[model samples]
Target chain A: MKPFTQHSGIAAALLVDNIDTDQIIPSREMKRVSKLGLGEGLFAGWRYVYDGAERAGENAEFVLNDPVFRNATILLGGANFGCGSSREHAVWALADFGIRAVIASSFGRIFRNNCARNGLLAVELAAEHVDRIAAQGAEPVDIDLEACRLTLGDGTTIDFDVPPADRDMLIRGLDYIDFALRYADDIDAFVTRDRRSRPWAHLRASES
Target chain B: MARTLFDKIWDRHVVRQLDDQSLLVYVDRVFLHERTGSVALTALEEEGRRVRNPQHVFATMDHILDTFPGRGDRTLVPGGEAFVKTMRRTANDVGIRLFDIHDGRHGITHLISAEQGITVPGLVVACPDSHTCTLGALGAIGWGIGTSDCEHVLATETLRAVKPGQLRVTFDGALGPGVTAKDMIVHLIARYTAAGARGFAMEYAGPAVEALDMDARFTLCNMAVEFSAFTGLIAPDATTLEYVRGRPYAPQGPDFEQAERNWSELRSDDDAEFDLEYRIDCSDIQPTVTWGTSPEHAVGIDGRVPDPETAGDHDAGRAMQLALDYMGLEPGQPLKTLPIDGAFIGSCTNARLSDLRAAAGILRGRRVARGVRAICTPGSQVVKQTAEAEGIDEVFLAAGFEWREPGCSLCFNAGGEGFAPEERVISSTNRNFRGRQGPRVRTHLASPAMVAAAAVSGAIADSREFAETGTNGQDAA
Candidate 1:
């Protein structure tokens, strides 16, 4: 859950989309404020269930039960990777599930911000690059945030390019809006200057 | 350029403009929730800063309230009753208005604001909740903020902000039979892929939008967030005025006349400027269902799962794979072939009385699918009580669906009675994001009647079958 520029770990691909907060960590499993193991709930439904319409036995026949990606890291995900309510649990669960970074084609705005603000390396790659990394079949891949590259097995390194702003925010471990607001002093001074220059520009506050 | 209502409102509200796209825009009305208010109040306390104006702030307790009765004395739920208690105390402690459960006004923050008439035309409102955009249906520009932003707004009645590009979605063709505003917007989301509306304020206009009733308009604007829009808006029209009249918060008598006169002109002028524009043929839109985790992964009810081989775009192939894994559907599979385990007919998006009435109308003589659990929750205490009084609850009860109290209920899974891991639910709530209803609870977002129809047929029923029965308002318009 640390947001440092230099950290590398095993990559366990979630390889799914729409991993909502509730599924990321069910409300029942989220009482303690402590950042505990949320990986178990990452795909609890798919990894452990099978029945007529409903998954049988919390641990039944399901795709996640395949037992290969049990502790994999670096999830290779689908588009709109996290869409729904603005709950941060989805990021927490993914990070806890041993995913150091997520390589997705695109990420939900809120989910992406939540991940960065809370310290999750969301790697946005073009679809073909993601497909190549995902095509590496159950093998571990390496992600280097500093070098902005993801290395798969077979000694192949696929470099990733991120926007400088996002890269700075990630490397510095700062929230985008939070970082912007930290300059409130300068912002306030500029506002005062602008108001002085254009008196008619000033407007009243919303009604009392 | 002539100022839009937004410009007029913004001009009146710009306390100042700061650098980095942050303007000290004045907040006309501020709505507070338990979590954000705690942060706001805590900051003011740490700084020993007293509020400049408490009367302008309104607080509600819906954020963490318990929606399920069986969750063990309600005390078992996390911060359930305490949030309610804290909201009241926080409001009182900070000299703000509080809407508690017993006040008969406890519900979604946006619902309370609109119903209270505290949200009005040409106002800039901000809450710590996203659905705050719901008020835009009334022509006010309501935006959601973070807790820190909430602190700023509460302390100074102003928020740093940036104006957004505007997009217009005009629609032609009368709505097809069985098409709800929910369907139309889902079609919009499916077509635009959620982020298409990014960096813009969406203005929903045209014959299709104008034809929509107020409740439908609210449903359309309420979901503007799902499409990545900063805010969704509709100009205040006669329909908007009519919906506002006689509400507890709307003006009365002489004041009402002035308000109506002002509201009548809230539409965009013929030469009004917009950065982008699009159109939708409402009649071409159909009952939609999502096949993947994202709201954008949707197809018309009659549509089938997309085959990745034919998917020309690389992202499309990944979407196809994701749909296959998450939704458990094969390529080219029909959505209706899949079975549904539960049905939900409530959420801030579609739980109004009119929404309930439509669900009731569709379920009048039909029984829910055997082994399928269906629950219908009203958006507010008033809606629940009134629906029962009007026998709408009787219709749901007769159909064997659980009639629950007012709250987010199964939609948010906060009630603890949400989707079992791996269970599929057909819901009328917005957004089908993974695990939204419950853990592993694959959710299919649909209109109320579509949910009811699914409940009746035990699967995705051809809405046309029931829609053909002449039961709903399909033919009336």
Candidate 2:
């Protein structure tokens, strides 16, 4: 994971509600066992036009495909963005496509967690603030994880909310497993107590 | 202080508080499937981590596996073989149990977890699939996670997480005949919107919920994620206990009695308070179906397509218009008698033995209408064998529906087999997202019996009509 302290880049607005993971990267495009090379498949359903199963050409109508926003690194989205599927490939695809942060009114719970783990900043702002940011069009926006602020090209600043733990993880690129492992003794103690209380819940090798 | 069922389970699993908002919660079970399991396991191996409790971890080869008879490693989805091979090898190397394709226990991860009794009351279950919430129907705390979380659970058996707010959705009154659990959930999503339960854990309660059987409860809880809930669950009752007793992974004899005693205590206190509450009258629910891409675009079978002009606000109206364009539907068009090209009855949402029985009841002595391609894939090998023993497969076959092998077939086009492009399909699957079935394909989510009704009529028709008057004017029962 790459640490994300601050980033300044063009922001493309896709203001459609319920932009699910399937639209981010369709199940058909996730044909590989590894996570690499997913950028090419990001929004394949909308980014490219298919002529009978083959990618014939790009769909110029899509916001990200528009020439002016071709290099966007921040995404402005509608409410409940990334609303379906727990597939992390959706986040990976966005990161691979050069998106460093996403500003939305809300997000799917699991998708937000995936973004935290992967160092992709997911900032939840008011819907009006998101609309204001999207109104900036092909202008560059600034995201400061440490300050919890987004600055538009016109110098208008908007505050956003990222959970404290998620902000810490993104800023430091911390592996959550490392943090959880620090409390190994605590986990062991709980397991021991739980085993004594609910033996049926713990499955032994033979019983399993 | 009275505590809700979620608080009870969550507090019991807490190892330590990481922050004011987050805790290190112990996970009791971890289930995985080939599609995402291989990636997680491979990452763990690369990181030189071993599964802390391999015995509690289970894997299956359901996702991306072909559902055709005599299916093997080869799949229509390009590069799908690598996922299957890697999952088998990695799970074996990790020393965790793997329900490979030939294994009688092989099935969709969520169904197999309950079928094998891996998900019991008050346990914390984690999986890489969103439908992992389906296990919550058994009184467990189950939620979907990303691959990184999977690796974390495998390495430490604990997750660092924030406790979500609780929402109690009570369905009172008795559900009318032919109105199944699937309808109850779809109605909730449509009324409340897809993101209604965001950042909250939901509990299904009240009289109507208690009246549902264990299988029906599973159907109700399966779409919790569609409502954008962290997870959803029901209190353990006699139905849940009877379903778990004597399962392969359930406790035996005296241990079972002890387990039952504990499960009996797994309900919300009488004075428990939730962050939010919704009380719905079950009588108001009808056999619901999605008319557009998102599950939120659903309406009762007798309802008409919503016109974008009246769809509220500018953004909402634009989204509706786009959905209508993609689905090729008119604003005022009625959902009934809308012709369809295909019908599917499979996926974790409604592919259990009871689901198969419900569909077969409608298909017996009836044939699919001409030009309609119908197919049925059981949820698991166990479901398939059990349905065959009950002679339900013959009903589907005689109705011109293809009775295929058990797997998550045609659910999301991951298997490379789906309705043709631009084809409209009435399916029992949970999602109706754009191109979810195939390129440019349109899907409408419904119950198993509803899908059967559509297949017979070659159009979107009410299953209750058939339920009231038998398919051939004789008693369907």
Candidate 3:
């Protein structure tokens, strides 16, 4: 995982609210045995037209199909991005497609957590700020994680909020599991205490 | 200090606090399905980490299982059978319970969890599927997690999590006839768009919610994922106790009595404060259905499809227009007049015995409309057997509906058994997204009874009127 510092890239605007993970990558494209090569499945349903069991051509109207935004590294999404399904494949698709940062008004809980684990920068901004960014018409935008601010091409700066822990992990490029392991002793102590307090809740070894 | 139901459960499960931010909360149970569970289980094995508590975990082959009669390990989705086989092998190697295709307990993860009493009140349940919140209807702290998080929970039996801010949605007036819990949730989502409950732990309270049966409560909480809430719950009461009593895995004898005592105190206190609150008169909520892609794009059954010009914001208006184009619908058109090419009646969202019974009642002496293809997939093998014993399957089959095996059949078009591209469908499933059932297929989300009505009429007909007046002379709403 690379520590996210700053990036400037053309933004691809997706103005539809409640863009769920299923729409990001439909279930039909999730039949793979491995997590690799899922970029082809990113927005599979919306990305192409099916001509009787074969790919006919790309849907030219989709934002991703726009040649100008083809290499977009930043995504300007509507409210409630990554709203459904816990498939980390959604993030895998975005990262595989070179989208390092996704700015939205809000995000689904598990999707945001998955983004953190997968080293994807999920930036939550106010809806109006997002609207302004999307209206820039493919202008390059800059994001500075250390500063926690997004700079529009119009010389306007808007501060964003990131939880302190999430911010620290991003800057340091730490895996959440490794970070969580630092508190293993705390987890052990709590479990031992809970086993005593709620004896009935914990199944005995023989129960299995 | 009095606490909310979720607060009580959260406090009980806290193993230790990580800091002022999050707690290492003990996960009481974890359920897995073939779709994503194989990844986590295989990862745990490859990483050489044995499941910390094998007894607390369970796996099932539901998502990719073929619902066709006499089907075995084969599936239509490419590599789906491999997923099933891998899950079976991994679950066996780990010594955790595996509900294979032949297992009588085999069913959708959420439904089987509740049916077997694995999702009892005051417990914390985790699964790798988003609709895991469906179990919250039993007063459990159930929510979804990704594969990586699922692996962590398998290795540690706990998750790092912050306490979600609480939001309470209360419904007062009585729900009119033919208006099921499905209608209530669809209405709620339309009122508060998909992100209305974002980041909050939601509690559905008030007289109407309390009056719902256990199965109906499951229907209500199943769509919490659509609301983007961390989870949605209803405090356990005597109704819940009765539903769980005598189940295969529920506590018995003195243990049951002890559990009951604890669950009785699982209600929010009168003075409990919420970060947000909403109130709805249930009577105002009619038999509702979505006319577009998002669940929030819904209206009453008698209402017309919305016009984009009235969508308030420009972006919203554009989105609405796009949805109308995708759905092939026109503004101001009555939903009842919109014909469907097929009908589906199964999913984790609404495939229980009650849902089956409702659909059967509508199809008892009726026939599916000509040129309309309809299928009924039971939620589980147990539900399938029970419905058969009660002659519900016969009723559906006689009415020209295909009575298939239990699994997530056509809810998602992952399996090959789905409507053709551009075919419009009225489904009892939760999501109605574009290509959700098939490429370019339009889906109208509705309850099982309403789906049956649509199948019989070949259009989006309201079940309320169909029930009051028989289907004999019914035109549209």
- Displacement of the residue A78 alpha carbon in candidate 3, Å: 0.7
Q: DockQ, per-model, please? A: 0.15, 0.81, 0.59
Query: Highest DockQ: which candidate?
Result: 2
Tell me the tens digit of each residue's lDDT in model 1 across B281-367.
Answer: 776798888777667778889888877677666565665576567767788788885799999988778988778877777789888
Q: Which CAPRI category fits model 3?
A: medium
Model 1 chain B poorest ten-residue lDDT run:
B468-477
Q: List the candidates ranked by lDDT, beginning with the highest.
A: 2, 3, 1
> Which stretches of model 2 miss by more than 4 angstroms?
B467-477
Better of 1 and 3 by lDDT: 3
Model 1 misplacement above 4 A: A1-78, A88-107, A112-208, B2-12, B34-53, B68-85, B251-265, B467-477
User: Residue-wise lDDT of candidate 1 within A15-51, one digit each (tens)?
Assistant: 5444544455555554432334666656654565546
> To one decimal place, how large is model 3's interface RMSD in Å?
1.9
Candidate 2's residue-wise lDDT over B1-477, tens digit each?
A: 999999998998999988878888899999999999999999999888889999899999887998999999889988999999999999999899999999998888899999999898889999998998898899999889988899999999988898999999999898877888899999999999888897699999998888788788888899999999999999999889988999998888888889888888899999999999988898899989999988999999999999989966555677788899999999899999999999999999999887888888888888999999999999988999998998999989999999988888999885778788889999999999998898899999999989999999999999987753221110122
Minimum summed lDDT over a 10-residue window in model 2 chain B is located at B468-477
lDDT against the true structure, per candidate, is 0.69, 0.89, 0.85
Q: How accurate locally is residue B195 in candidate 2, as Cα lDDT from 0 to 100?
A: 86
Model 3 scores a C-alpha lDDT of 0.85
C-alpha RMSD in Å of predicted model 1 compared with the true structure: 5.7
